[model samples]
Target: MTLGEGTHTIIAVAMGVDGQEFPSAPVTFSVRLALPAPQITQPEAGSVQDMNLWIGGTGADYSAQVQLLEDFNHDDYGYSLVTLTGGWGRLFNLAPGVHSIVARQTINGRQGPVGIAHFFKVRPSRLTTVNVEILPSQEVKFSGTGHNGATVVLTYVSGPNNKPLPEVVVANGVWQISAPDWENGIYTYSAIQKVSDNAGGWIPSQDFQFSFPVSTKVPDPTNVRASADYSPIFSGNGVTGATVLIRKQDGTEAAPPAVVVNSFWSSQSRQEWGPTFDQIVQVKQRLDGQESEPGVGVVVRIAPLPPVISSLSDNELSPLIAGTCWSGAVVNLVFSDNPAVHTAAISGTEWQFRRRTEFAPGVPHTVSVTQTAAQQTSAPATRTFEIRRTLLKPVIIDPANGGEAERDLRVRGDRSVAGARMQLRVDGIDTGPATLTNGGLWYIELKGLAFGRRILDAQQTLDGRPSERSDPVVVNVVLMPPQFTTPQPGGDLPRTSTISGTGMPGARVDVWLEGRDDFLLRGYPVDSNGRWSSLVILPVGVKTLQARQAIEQVVSRDSPPLTFNVVPAAPYIETPVKDGHIGGSAVVSGFGVPGDTVSIYLGDTLLGGAPVLEDRTWSVPVTLTQPDGAHVLVAVASLDGFKSDRSAQQPVVLGRYEPSIDSPRAGSWVSHPVTFSGQGRLGTGQLVSWFNPELPWAPNLAVSAQGWHGLSVRALPAGGNWCRFQQTIVDGADASTISDWSESARFEVLDPASR
Candidate 1:
């Protein structure tokens, strides 16, 4: 039960086993509210105080004791009790460096919750004569004057608090301590001198504090780099206001000292070296009379040497410019008359660049080359050379050197140099510049040349320079032969056809069959466009034909031979109608031209051939070898050596008619008259025959579509007998169309008494 802040009365009750209640005397008690924790109003948190300090706070209950707890501990040095007056209390004479104090209010053995913790620092007595020194080896020492025979205890206060230092004993009113391996920073320490009080205890005076900075060594230089100039500049980062020094690998100074500004420093060497020079050096910084350790080795490289040209004499217009240079250097070429600058990378010690455009013919040129490496350029190497005039001889393409040509001839040729014009020479007479096309092709037409053998040659000129005359093309200035324009070579033609060609205008074209001295068609006039046609009945054979043109009485050589075939008509297949079935050794008959030969074909396979009779009917025997399936057959007719096109395709079916016996099987016992059954094509008829020793010949039995119960044979010997079947005429036809017999089925025939 919780009690309120007021006076209350409670009664105790006693109960017996009989359920009767007895009441005791009433008890009265007073309930009072707990006093709130105090608030420290004087010497705020984080404030620095002197040795003789007073800490005060406000409280709600003036009659309560304000307990001040130092460093949050209840030990002898921390617990303190003080009486409050007018709701305020003070804690006096608190020793100090840094302190944390919490206050609580207590009344009648009841204490309230602790107040907010307050932290602050107390200023110890300032030591005026304290001396601090950092030795060259980074050791720190502290010394000061204190009371005679007193011992001084040191506690680290701030700045790099690594560990507690050892105590020092004062002798002759002086105390000193040395700390080794001290880092570089400002450090504050509190010193307390303790004297004997003659009661087996010592009294500690107020703290005497001191602070000092130690900087024994400067930092080493970083990020050191050098330029590729003859007198290079070395630069890096270091401590501000430090002097940076450049030194050789042997510890000798290489350049004057440079002061660091804004954490960066650079030093340029006073003396210069050759362009290809390189060296290794170190860098360091010094500040406040202390020097740092040397940095890593830095490489300094100078510019590359000038390149050397190999040679410059060549006949090619776009020649290769090659030279020797330092490995990994860029070689640059600059011409005196050309504005463009070309560059090439050195593969090893050599570099080369091919000019894209040709140099002017027979002109002197001066080219200078230089090598650059490590961001530095070298001096230029000079060379002068002239491009010699050496033009290739032109080549005549048309009007063959020893061939015949027409009087009004067109001369064509090609030049080695592009965009060069050609000049023609006929019979040692010069013809002005001709038409030149892209890709170095040139042509010129000469009209009405003398009707005799003529000499033709040409020369090419470029950029006002002439090339050597070409090898002379000697041609006969006569009428040119006609070229066949119809009935193309390797084509099939009818016996009566027209042949046409092109020749010189108004020329008389004479056409002749090959191997015939006499002309087949004479005096065919060519039209203005050099076209002529002749109608003739060609012989029924493959023939070669040629034509020649004659303007006057002189006839020119024959044209290129044109070969063609005069074919006969395609033959018609009279037998074996479309989609019909044929068996072994079937005869295929067709109708064709009287003297032509007809060849039968099954798919692409040749069957056999037969000549057409005088009555125009032909027949050929073909033994079918293909499996039983549908196939296509075609007929072609040939006369002389020319064959006609294939006739209309006739799709047909082929079958192998050998049948197998399934009942009274091979090697089985059977009675005198046995039934032979087998499987065969549904539309085919089967013929069964047996070899019996008692009979000279066995009769053939025909069965049509009987499936597996097809045939029965009688009169067998009382021993082993063999029987076979073959497909005879399909659809129950006669036996004239029979296939080869199948393998014999051997079976034992039992006599009637032996069954």
Candidate 2:
């Protein structure tokens, strides 16, 4: 059907079989002229361009719009309205790809058919060269030359992923992009140049792959140190295979370059620099044609100077050897005649060393000293001096001529130098060295001295020279003091006590009382086996006694003072009369000296004690633990820390009145009435009772002097029955005492049928 280019309306009706017609609702529509397909004239078929280009076509209605399609998928790239003057239309920015384009036009809402497809391509941009550089500041920069006015798009390809990088526009055929924060590693990148189309849109090129290695910078030298010597050595740590350079603070080379091996580097200065002055230097490292910044300056110190010796006086013994040296230096001193060396650390600029061993008397001795600092030693300085010969003989102050000393004797003397060595001569034999006190007195302990008359002397040595022996002093090495076997310390003693002890035979012992010059017993005899005895009368008071032993005219030192109390008569225990019976708690009474305490004893065990009153009478309560047997007891009196000997023995007996059945032992079979017998305390009354599951009254059984007997029990039960007994003691007008019930004795009555 032919239609004009304008809106029009029409309607239709339905006709039935009987020739009757019904009109339908009116429908609206528009009629417009059909437009012809557009033709592309700008880009010929199969033609190629480096960037997107504008495409135009003719033969479309002037009022129609042209739509551009691209690629095999027929995607609409763009659309444009036809111009009224020439009936032509254009589309812009066709992307870079081998493409086929078909154009269609719509005139007054009526669409035309698609035109024939046109084949063309927008070629990818081109790049001639690409390079990657790592700046000194560790920034990564990518640069290349490509088509003019083209944008260089870079994508960092890491593993299987791609990251878009910032684009750079090419100017004068060159382009560059910087990644200032990129880490140090090998990196791969794919780049493409994007050129602008005629409509000012970008067209991407094919990917170009490239790789670059971003290396870490070389590290500066660390721990730079220099030794203080005539030829100093510099050392530090750096990267392996790198070169370390050292320069003075003034920028002049201080040492030749040294290559680092195993992260360590060392360089020695070629020229000799004396130890008189200090120097400062800097260090740097270079690796792979790259240099690192210099490190902090290091100072090299000067060597120490030789130690100086102070003036020395002649004839001085144990001289003070002092000198001056550099600060922080160690001063070493070596003696010419001695093989030992001594050293002293410097304090500030001064050093001192004292001579401990005395120098040879009356002979010149030389000593040399040197100072060392910072591993450098100086030359030696020397001094010479002599010690004086001034040793005096020592005189024996103790153990006078003809005096005696026992074993382990202490010998003392005087007239010796404070620090001089002293020795004793015993009967012409030299003993070991003695200890000298600060007051110029010397003493030595001599053990195991023989018992004989011995001559004693002493000698003094100073500055390695010994003086002649002092005037001879005769001494008698006698027996030690007698030890007392009786009357131990802090024990009681009576008048007319005999003091006996052991001592060397043939030696006589003399006993003396404290605060008295005269001996109480003199010339007491000592028997064989080193035994001695002395019978002396002591006063009635506290006494301290001492004894000494003597052979011929020499006497030993007095024995350790023995202290004891001289007590009077012993105490007497009167109560619990001799051989009397005791049970449970009992009273023990005794007679003692007034103001004394009496302690009672059973055998060796202490029962209890009581203080004596003004009447000289004492009583104490004692519990008896002895089982029904006879025991002995005694009483001792103590007064003023002195105890008297135990008094005469008093015998007693302990007993319990509990009764027991002896006849018809437990678990026995018997007839109707049971007979029982038992033992208990004499003179006590016992009661027997029986129970066959029921308690029954029984009669009291008398306990005579020989114990009780003949107690009978009667029961009719043909089964088990038991009986028990208890005791009581009744003494004139005293309350009765009852004992606990004894264990039950069970027995069975015989049944006639069963028997």
Candidate 3:
């Protein structure tokens, strides 16, 4: 039985089966089956108008899915699914005149018998590529024959991740999508037509993927980290020529570690290892490149070293025999920190580092961490890690001051640097400088300067980013006084504690103290902001900020101290601060020093002075005598005699006065002689007038002019006075022109009997 659009009960077993009647009280069918819904995502004929297929009757799917297939190449590949909405599916973009037949739909993990197949020819989609362009908004565009009404999808491919993002709709096959969200990273994107195949399938074009990562744009670089493994090494400061195997990423000898891969042309060899201990190894890639992200990554590996051994001088417990050459037996390797093993079986084994070395004449084999240092990570450490036995003496690195006496400056170092910090002191006083990262770029931000040479020093510790000053590195810095043009600056610019004056081609400028960082870009061009082409964020409040410059690199010089003053941003109320408004009084609080003046207002009227006390509190007495309506109350505060910014408006409701007309009620005609009166807040002196609903406004008539029977009235709280009114109408003239004429008592011919 077919049911209407409403709900209907479906029975697997009939209400009564084979002459056996089932209980009508509660009906339950034991038969379980599913019917698949037909999917006509693809059109059947080349240009079938009203086409439909019965992929499902009652025996198919009990809400099952039907999947159909459409193969452009006719290779017999049809997929299965179940879902059909909208009208019958029709094939699009059909060849001008070619007959094709689709049959045998796949459903519910099974193939069904071929239903009636239809043959038809399809003209190629009228959609011709009129034009494809990149929009100013960066969205790819597509236009063509029928493209005007076609659904288009834009896709982009990224090279760095080797994946493509989901397609986006640039427009409804019309204008352009101004802002494209596809730019999560550097990628190349293009638009394509998302049309249906004539049969029951979807067809995609073999168009070329957009060239990505957009050649002009670079993706977030891939971080590559490379390190070396050694059995034993020297003081790291003495070892001469050393050999390090370059380990690559893909178990090859080319991929290096700690590399920022951003471009397609940036292919590298996977080599594991480099030189060690006072030896130099070229990075093989661009030397001064930056990583995309702030974090470090291991993208490449160096070949495992053949294993070298050191610390032979410390083996005092043993002596050499009359004749013997030692292999790797006496001295063993210990690599618990940054460990490495040739194989999983060799992992954490003593043989990997085992060695045989003699102390001198006669002795027993020895192993001691006391005479040996743990692995040493030295400067220019591309992929090779420092592996020496250890002592408590940590490795210290310095910028240019030999790791000593410095002021208002930063020191750089590497290895075990994460969670590490440096401390700085300017001049002779300790001026807390900027903190540095594990990558070894320390900062000493300085503020407040006196022009001249200043000193800065730094110290560091792990786990905590701070400095107490162990190594004092000297740097010449200065605080240059700020200068501005004569025009009244519309906005207050930041107050910098630096003074800068560039000289001709041959001038020596000396900078010292905490302000030295500003001079780092002396040799380079500068931006309009007066910032050096290579300027970096400098530490604030650094001491001993000074700089000196001369006419030449070695001759007459000028030196001065750096003074900086950054104008703090003005603070305003983020949210309206309101207080209890009782008896027309409210207290407001602001974020500023106390003893400031504030203004209070009710509606648009200013009340009076509301000064903040030492506690930053300002209160004012405000009586809201306003009409019956919502009102906005405003309060403002000022600092240092500067013009104050108004606080957010506070919403409030003014008390309402209920008024009523008491006498000669409404609907009274103008011809009536009725008394008019009302109760209101208006005083006895307030003016009152009579009015009619027919007039645009109540007339301002005098007591004598209103009407002979009506009187001019005033509002009163207790009783009545000229508080009543009465009126009469004259037919011949307009009601407005007829003044209160008591003398004209004739609608007759001078006598009542004359009619």
What are the lDDT figures for the candidates, one per model?
0.73, 0.72, 0.34
Highest-scoring model, TM-score: 1
Higher-lDDT candidate of 2 and 3 = 2
After superposition, candidate 3 runs with Cα above 4 Å error: 1-409, 413-421, 433-450, 461-471, 479-755
- The digit string of per-residue lDDT tens for model 3 on 40-66 reads 323434443212122221222333333
Q: What is residue 38's positional error in candidate 2, in angstroms?
A: 99
TM-score of each: 0.34, 0.26, 0.19
Model 3 scores worst on lDDT over the 10 consecutive residues at 232-241
Candidate 1 stretches greater than 4 Å from native: 1-403, 408-410, 414-416, 423-433, 437-450, 453-475, 481-502, 513-519, 525-536, 540-547, 552-554, 557-591, 603-625, 630-651, 656-755
- Residue 736's lDDT in candidate 1: 34
lDDT of 2 by residue, 658-686 (tens): 56767567888876555666776544444
Q: What lDDT score goes with residue 146 in model 1? A: 72
lDDT of 1 by residue, 602-679 (tens): 989999999999756799999988765667899998887788889989877675666666767778987755666666
List ranges where model 2 is wrong by over 4 Å: 1-392, 400-410, 414-456, 460-466, 471-491, 494-505, 510-524, 527-563, 567-584, 587-598, 601-635, 638-642, 645-755
Instruction: List, in order, the clash count of every candidate structure.
Output: 0, 0, 159
Q: Total clashes, candidate 3?
A: 159
